[model samples]
Target: MDESLSHNDEAHASSSHSGSRRGGWITFPFITGALVGLTLAAGGWLSNLIVFLIEEFHVKSIDAAQIANVVNGSSSFFPIIGAIVADSLFGSFSVISISSCISLLGIIVLALTAMLNSLRPQPCVVGSELCQPTSTLQDAVLYTGIALASIGLGGTRYTLATMGANQFDKPKNQASFFNWYFFTLYSTTAVALTVIVYIEDNAGWRWGFGLCVLTNIIGLAVFLSGTRFYNIDKPQGSPFVGLARVAVAAFQKRKLQLSSESKDYYDGHDGVKEGIVTGTLSNSFRFLNRAAQKIEGDIRSDGSIAKPWRLSTMQQVEDFKTIIRILPLWSTTIFLSTPLGVQSSMIVLQALSMDRHIGPHFKMPSGSVIVIVLLSTAISLTLIDRFLCPVWQKLTGRSPTPLQRIGLGHVLNVLSMALSALVESKRLKLAKANHLQPVVPMLALWLFPQLVLAGIGEAFHFPGQVALYYQEFPVSLRSTSTAMISLVIGIAFYLSTGVINLVQRVTGWLPNDINNGKLDNVYWMLVVVGVLNFGYYLVCAKLYKYRNVKGADVNSGSADSEK
Candidate 1:
């Protein structure tokens, strides 16, 4: 046993020495550049998709919005699957490399659709009474491009963040990387929203999509160039299988009594050596500890468990409990994200109906208007990291906990929804006074404050959630932890779609033309929902205890509460 531990120590020391020489901040530039290129490519096409569908495909405005929502949802949701694959089969490097290539292909296909007249419906004539619908072939080609792009995005986006974080050994460095990761992400998105959207609106759709293809190729190349500098982690087989084993073992031992003595539980090592876990089992969730309890004949002569379903290691048991404990807190984020998804989709429709002109020469593209959120988020992240965190540390003598940041975000989110409600009400009043014309006289800039507030809210919660999950989740599930936010966003977008559909069917809040509908009421409903969700989040935060808060300096007062 001593020899085995010494070998492990030597291997770890060697790995640390190698890591010091190759990885760390040295790899940041290449990874950051890759991230910027990928974001520019994705944001360019995704942001302008609704407009593309409406103008090129001749789809109805509402249908285009719904399609855009689905695409966004799919892009967000697929990361969970990608993360699982990275954890269980291929590591993040291989998955990211393959996914980037796939994205390049997808962008090329999309560019072809834009350049080829045969791939799209006939252009709608000005002042035409009716527009021709897209044929089956056109629809198939369009969907194929979208599917490929979404899958590619899902596989690469968050996985890259995980890989980048893995390169750094320190938790503080990992946290810093997350802030910069999001900042870079939003900054590139802002460029795409303004510059790329302008190109699409002015130069043409084909040029814009061609640029996406070019950027994707460049990004993939840059990422590949940094291969030697990255400290890549190996796939650790399936963590989910281990989790499942814990549950199965617990059930199989349901009839057996749980032992009070430390010697009675399996700890994934030699029975006489006291095993990996030296301490007494945590009394909380004692029911799950049954899985780790040892019974007669449960262990082989070699100290391996004879039946996998009848016994589990204490570490496995604790990992399962950690997931169970965090689930309620995790669930609150879904509702928080759902309303934002609804607002994002609905806001575009609002911008479409409002006066989009900033000057006689410059009419704002509706897609680019949403960039206000990204811009605000980028700026807010800088402020939070540079200013707010230091002030918080000075005043409180400790940094704000993840829960505190998330709570503040909840407040900001509710306020943003209320602001949106108010803005929409004024816009509706203006439209009603103008006799519900094709376009209202109100400037689309009126929407910026709500978007900015939402952005600030995101700056607070998004990274906080990422940090919380990455810290709390078991080491084996680190990639899965980072991808959890993507899963929440994806589910929320789908729920947003459902909520919008339900609202349209039950009330007059969302018509095909939002200007003719009670759009203000939708925002108000979101505000109400946000408030309720915030209340639920507070309850969960109050009850939840941090499993790994030591040395984190997470507002020691808050840490004390967990005790």
Candidate 2:
């Protein structure tokens, strides 16, 4: 559980695991292969969910968009809980295995809904006054399937990423595994968007949902096959408990004078002398130093604290401080993700109304439009690693720090919003000209430019945020660190859902038929949001200091700038 002894633990694990010849590069294929299957299943159903709801459930377009956002929010949000459970109750392997089976059951339920007409409402003809509304019973059936699927998908994704990283000891090997992990994630989602969505659009919904079910089964199978080879970490109590204890102890001893001498503080267990390894207590967040300041009766005749809530180790207080310092930077990411959440649903609606033809005979599915973002991100990731980072290093004499990379992403995110507004303005004008038609005269491809920009922005920010959190967070919260991005994204999606509801109530910008509404105004609104967020991000980046500063790390220069 000690951060300083992580390498020693890994070394111990390696020697013990080596006897059985388990847990190294040997488990890589199975994990990555499982990630592929799981991601495919998730994207196949989730990506196409809005269309499915509107087409089969007799839900209104705007209502379906709201539902999609909510589902996406839940899917993003649940991973943190999954990570916590993995870290506190069960190991990653058990959590993933159980979650995968849950996902498979959920997908099977979804497939059943598509296959059985009785489970869904009567299909409504578009723009028809005689269409039947979905009954409460029908709605319940659909929601049950969605809730199950969302919970299942949420539990697996990031926990799987953490599990994959745990398989190796070397940072270099761990880094390589992450590269392949993300590549598989994006690439498999792309496959789902194109292949599975095409089947739903062309063949039958039943077939597409059935495919998801198959992939879920295969993913579970592949993951379970690798059980003998994983380096599973057992639960070491709740990390959050330590943080909470720091806050409680600080409050309880608020009246106590702060300590100046090193011996006054509790240096963790093992009876190691004070100031030997931990040095002195941090000066920042000085009020919290009371938590570590020893008082009579706080410690037993032995070294450990008698009342855990009244006193904490110096390391615990420092870990709590680390979270507080990084929070401002983390807040900036919610706004970054919020605009994309709104944009995602809006773009799908735009694609549904516009011309979707590809020359002679092919017509693109509305959901498949998101594949543009995925493909662009994957390509941009390659370009950033191969060309942009090197060019940046040459130009600046140092590699870009995580903050710098995230800053670039903010700029690009703002630009993407502006482009989205402009493209929507054009689409709206064309929609007015063809108001009587089912589809607008404009090509759906017109929306591609904005989507590609958003994708490029993600390529910069997503990994940057991941790296920043992983490097900056307390080692005890490693699983939680990766899930923090998901937490940001989840909140963003939920915020977007709230924003959409507010817009619906207040303005005519996002009507059921966007052809008659001012969706451009919505994009323009997001443009403003992005600009404000980017400014806030700049302020946070300016004031932020990197905690982890190895000589060869990209962040070392930025850390030095703080001096």
Candidate 3:
């Protein structure tokens, strides 16, 4: 009787533990999502401000792009590192807390700079010069503050998003949740991109950045305070080491086989059961672990390698190679980002060159108009996600497909760029002919194309596709994989600047000069790139297949938000 009672007690305890473990995963999506929304809002605000500042401050667009790109790169670049840290050691909560604080400090600097700028006022100059020829020392301070904040923002980009998605554990439910989760991110942007920008531009750029800083502070506080609400996963160990191991296994497959002489993988009368390595989970997991060991052993043994197949996991994670497998499909994202990024650079320049004085009584800040458009996007996103997504699912018997949303957005990106280019081209001709700024900033009205089309595209594309990428990455590599996709956008910004500089070098064209700012040509360049990206996606559509990792393993039901 005593033995039977003990067995019953043990069974009950096991059941309770199993129940707790199962329930824990549901929180993953919410946690990662909150962080993603916060970071994306900051991204939109920064992208908007950077453009206006360059024009208003009379700096070159290429220079401004480079500065903003620096922060953009960081915000994107750090995700792989954060993913590795999160997957292996720190866990999601610690990673988010640390990264959010880093970003928060950067925002504080910007807020201070904004507060300082409020002291100097010169509205009279607003209507006269197309751009500020010189900024007070305080202006430089503002730029630096914004840049630092962008860096902080970039670092947390991937980590929090990944962490949030990890909470939902059911494959089917996880699938539905992912769609909803992405919707939240884009919807929030529609709000931030529009409302935040409008307030900042109408009030003051400093005030705009200052508000962002305050918002970030609130985000940080909310995140930290809600720490207890999070589903803290068990820390696996150094995710970098794990990734390295997988790379090693992949690279050293032949070597390992030769050394084992096919003996390591036992071929028994009952069939085959491969020898598993330590610190590895499943078959693929072990293969990776074993590969890492073999690679390390080879490195130690040979002392030299020709063509050196050793992959730098860091760069591999961010550069073309790691993501190249998916690039053909993801090419669409590149097209979408160009117009999205332009909301800051060329767009703002066009606004500056136009007649910004509206109706004698109102001098519209070009950047402010762009902000309103973005805020409108946020509202639209909310309506669509909350209402449209559900209603569409009921009517169509399917939700918004990632590919459809992505393709639609790409189309919109092109339209926005094309419209803006035309408006800008006309404004330039008018200004040049009159020997004065155009009667009205046509660019203001042209912003509608970007505001409306771009907003709609983002509502569908940004969140939908990003959620897909996160879902597709392997458990250990989830964060790193997501970072890989995001880095492309960041890299593209840097690349755009380089490309512009290269064009300037080859043709001896100065950027932002009235003659060179004949951006109709550059807009054409974007059009060509956008079309090519669209073509790339078509190719991917044929070869790519969606993987819902959650369906495969209860451990990561929230892993891939696949169709």
Candidate 4:
């Protein structure tokens, strides 16, 4: 196989997929990437599983955020580094391999800390009357464990996904490949969430955390197993450099060119899912990065012009300007984010209180609801997307685009949140009526609509936006572009927490007490979140620009790389 032919052969390949399965050695990358992704999720789940324990040990929410930030940041950090090393020294495959190892070590250490915690004398929970709280010691150990886990998880998350994307070429197969890529990502998450959460819920915290270690080992094994047939990327400088250079030029208001790569460079765009029209400047985020001088650069041959691409339309420039201007509106989705987020927080509280009954003799485990996560998501997507969507297409004469899917999800999100709030409201009324506990058996069932809605919502929302990002952003900013899109969810997570707290404070829902008092107000609050999320969706719908930029379509045949 002529090495140069790597370009010509793949140049024609679609960004979406390739039929070439690595029958021999190539399986290494595939298995490695998937394992990394699953392991990362498993590790993050462990952190969630034991977060209350940390709080029990008196670990403050600030400390918990530090630990979580480490894990979450990995999703962004590694790819930027990997993209650099990949374009410069080690390829994406190598970066992924290295990241997996790093993350594995982190999980191992975290597991060890858990073992130590089980043996240590834990501190008492704050505000205790008679009972001693063990949260202090638990908090110390969790802090250490989560710290290491975060670095590892963050590095792994970024490397694996970027590497996975590197596996496929673009243009012809771009769409289909993304569909499968997205399918696997969510499916893998669904599977991990279901099985792992149960262990955390039932098997004890130590084993639950240890499971991430198992996943890491599995991922390493899979990467090793597949050695041949992987599509390798040509090494370049840090993607950050390209982004930086492009950004500076965009603002100085100049024409854009590769300026870095010669014949050796190939343009790759990850946002193949965004359905923006060709020749349109609809990538608002990328444009902002340019103006900010962070993610600016040209996807063309080496040049000295030192200016950003002077896109023809000021309207397009304004489109980006418009989107950035409207970011605060999208930011409002954080409120809806708050309700959905209680899954690990208040929802878990509810889950614990539920009648853990499953079989005739066996009690349902606390974490068992996670099993429902995947099961419900798969069923709904297949039923709604595959069956219902096609029927709708026949009726409306159009297939559901990513945007349409988003709209549907927003609608579902409203309903899901409302259902949760209603259940909480009922729990309050039932408490008042019967002088009973605030946590109801029916609340567990009520969560069904919410969780199922979330899964369905993600299936459409994240993947759709990811597809859009790749299709629209300049090739240089592709990986970073996707990361930013992903960052929104994280931002939403933080914002949601704040909003929930604020509402609870204003309504006096905190310190939920002995009977059915404190939590009922909490339920009504979530109801409001659902309504607001629907409105945010509407706002985004009105302002978003739709553009589809193909790799080949945007390709400027210029040569600059000397190496």
Candidate 5:
């Protein structure tokens, strides 16, 4: 299948190649520059946002973490909306361009909140008992800035990625583009985590946010400069609408008798269809097959759909079934990320009360501690792609399946939670010994092993989910497949927020001062959650069968061949 597709792409590229054409390697620098600048700008403010909320807004530590999680959820969730808008109304280029400007405006607003005294509560010393809480108006302004920034950042990032991938015809070129794109994204983000976050901690929030604003502007400018070089695809109506039609049609036709004859179904007009189901629908989910069963007024003289809500094509019905079959597996990933969300926030809080000093001169920012996870993920991803995968294939005679990878990730995540429990228990004991002092005697570096393990888990699961969705989803929904992972992550963050709130309400494990509470118990709870979630994943994996076996094989080949 891959050989055939490669031949087709080569033929298409050779015939289409011309100096006058818009897309190719020529647009790489401009697009990559825009990506770097925007990603750097996003990370600059977002990476240290919990610290900003705690220091500037006089919010409680737990509340700040919750707010940050909400912000992260919003950022992750909005991409699906952006992708929808791009597919249904505007093109990717327009959406990306407009979104970048919005990000610039949002960052400018953020910079103002940092610069102006009126937008936030008065600064108070850390751990002060008499710190003033923010007023309603102050909260509104701060939330407005965060909302805009989240919307803008979410709108552009993934849309820009799709646009970059669309620029090349060859799979290899598109694959290479993604490699560089992620490299730029992660590397620039690492810089922001370190350099930009250090500036925010040392120079001032105003300076850090000001740099974000500048980069947003530069990134927008660079993206716009590539106007003539991009291969812009026109908006096709949302594939989701088609899926909805299938569900509606299926329900409306629920009473209709099912049929096995090819002539009984609407195979579509002029042989134009969305899936491999040309003459018949799949036997599974036979109730939906009635959706394609011919009835009066279902089609017009031209063979186009007359009442689309009442009747769908065979392909649409099959496509809907494909999604239904894959949903359980997708659901298991939400819990996979929920624990990480909790850990991300909890680690920052832990770092704040631990020894962050190195050699007694340089104090690491609490925010910078998360960078260890990022670095660990990056390093682990490289090793998995370069070394581990090959070794596994050589020893096993086949590359690891996505389910295998995700299962490994689940086990690692559970182990990381257990490790986190141990670390926190030690810290809590030390805090008790010291009478719950502001800073414990424990070193912040003690958190690294758990974080590194969590990062490695992500290296396995996140990409595995993405690859799974892309391979399994119907052709019409291919563009939206990548966003499915984002949706999972977004839901995970929100679920984590809910979990934290529940723990706070029901248990004394989480309090205003974590040192005084049983934070280790929270990690132990998450470990249990992880263990249960992993069991659920295993069940789902055992029940699920690959819908696109050929595609999966190709993906495995690509993974194996990656050097």
Candidate 6:
């Protein structure tokens, strides 16, 4: 018997050793490079979509802006479903691989549309009655490409972030990976905005979209090449199923008397105590504790639960409670992001109406101006990681908490909107003085400060939100946790469209021609919304207590102190 057990142990140990050797930092470069290529491809097409629709498809500028917002929303929204699919069915590697293929196909179709003259409407001459509308076939082809590309990009983006973090064991290592991940994402996106948008403007849409297709294929190829080195986690049953089971079990056991003894509740398969309460049930969400209450026939002779709906493991119960606790804080971020979405889409219009000339030789594409936000985010992330964080730790003897970082983001976001309002007010004054010409005397560079501030706010809050969710979420739901930020951004973009439509219907704040409208009022309204949202966030953060205070302390040194 001893010899048999020793042989089994040796085999298990050898398998683990092989897996460790095959994965880890050795695969980092390949994954990062794949991400760079993917970002370049996605950004190349998406950044100039509004311009393409207006110039080639003969869509009105405001209509094109709405389409772009919807596309952005869909791209963000589908990731939640993708994360669920990754965690529940396919796993990250399979999902990413499949999504990449789909993206490549979509980009190819999009490139064809750009290259084939019959696939689009006649080129619209600006300020001419000779412009042609798109055919039914052209519309069908364009929408198909948009849908496929959105779905594909959605599936792979945040899922890759989760997969990359899975390669690291330490929380610090995971945090560092997120910083670099966003840095790479923003940097590559900046390149696409400048280079690809320039190509689309100067060389034609065919060459630009062709570049997107080439990069997407390269990204897919690089990802597949690293397959042997990836630490692929197999999909367990859906975590959502486990959470639902907890709720059902609690409801079923509602009439049963509560037990004070620790042993009366199911601990887990190993019979080891694990949760915020350690041995006893946590007092916060007392009703959920009933899910783990041991009753007659709840346990079988083999030590498993006889009735799954009558009893659950303590870990399962706690996981559900953690999600419930974080929801209020999560909600505040939605309002925080809504204004940003509105600002980004509106800025393109603002740039179109303003002087975009940098020199006598060149005029900037409106899409390229948004790269200011990406560049600012990338540079700010580097400075924060290398300099600000270390200096903060030295002076304060602790790193900043996620809540603090998010709070600072809120303040900065409000300031960005306020600055935008002032800038627009000045632009409107200039437009009125210049007799509402197609281009105002004010330079597009005047729009940079607000975008830069918004970018800096993203640098602080985006990674902070990801880290907070990853650290706090249940192990089974970690992938979904990372995708939650994407979900918020998605919903916010949609809501921004609703807000704009409502404003357009009720007031003249957002006419098709922004120069004839009160654009400053819209920015001022966002400032008000941001300030109110920040207050709500403060209340939520203050009332909240960390479930994993020890882990939080190790990560930030100030999480417990804040409580």
For TM-score, candidate 2 versus 3, the one ahead is: 2
Cα distance off (Å), candidate 3, residue 538? 2.8
* Clashes, model 4: 63
C-alpha RMSD for every candidate: 4.8, 4.1, 8.4, 8.8, 3.4, 4.6
Per-model tally of clashing residue pairs: 0, 0, 18, 63, 0, 0
Error of 1 at 96 (Å): 1.0
Estimate the TM-score of every prediction. Answer: 0.90, 0.93, 0.68, 0.71, 0.94, 0.91
lDDT of 6 by residue, 1-563 (tens): 23423443444467644433244565678788889888899999999998888778878777788888889999999888888888889998999999988888888889989999899988667678578878899999998998898888998888888788776665555666766776687778889999999998889999999999999989988988887667677787678888899999999989888888888889875655332333556877898999999988989888988988778888888888999999999999999999998998899999999989999989999889999998887778768767887898899987777788889989999999999999999999999999998799999999999999999998888767866776688876765766788889999989988888888899988877889999999999999999999999999999988765666635442211111
Query: 263-308 in candidate 3: lDDT tens per residue?
Result: 2321122221223122212232233323323233243343332222
Q: Write the per-residue lDDT of candidate 4 for residues 1-563, one digit (tens) a residue.
A: 23323553455364345543322223434654665455544534543642544433444433343334434434435445555666678876676667667667766766776567573445554666344444566546655555555555555554555655455455323333344544565556655655665566567656876787887777776765564455556576554554344344465644323232222221123212234322333344443333322123433355322333421122233334544553553454445444555543555555544555655575544445555555665566556655765687799875555556556656666666666666666655655666565344453665566677666765555444544445454444565555654456555555545655575568656443414445645555566666766676777767765544233122210000000
The residue-level lDDT of candidate 4 at 538 comes to 75
Error of 4 at 68 (Å): 6.9
Model 2 poorest ten-residue lDDT run: 554-563
lDDT for model 1, on a 0 to 1 scale?
0.84
Q: Estimate every model's Cα lDDT from 0 to 1.
A: 0.84, 0.84, 0.55, 0.51, 0.85, 0.83
Q: In lDDT terms, how accurate is model 3?
A: 0.55
lDDT tens digits by residue: candidate 2, 274-333 = 333555678999999999888999888877789999988888888899999999999999
Q: Which ten residues in a row have the lowest lDDT in candidate 5?
A: 554-563
Please provide, for model 5 over 228-255, each residue's C-alpha lDDT reduced to its tens digit, 9 standing for 90 to 100: 6667777989999988998898899888
Error of 2 at 322 (Å): 1.4
lDDT leader: 5
Task: Show model 5 residue runs off by greater than 4 Å.
Answer: 1-21, 125-128, 270-279, 557-563
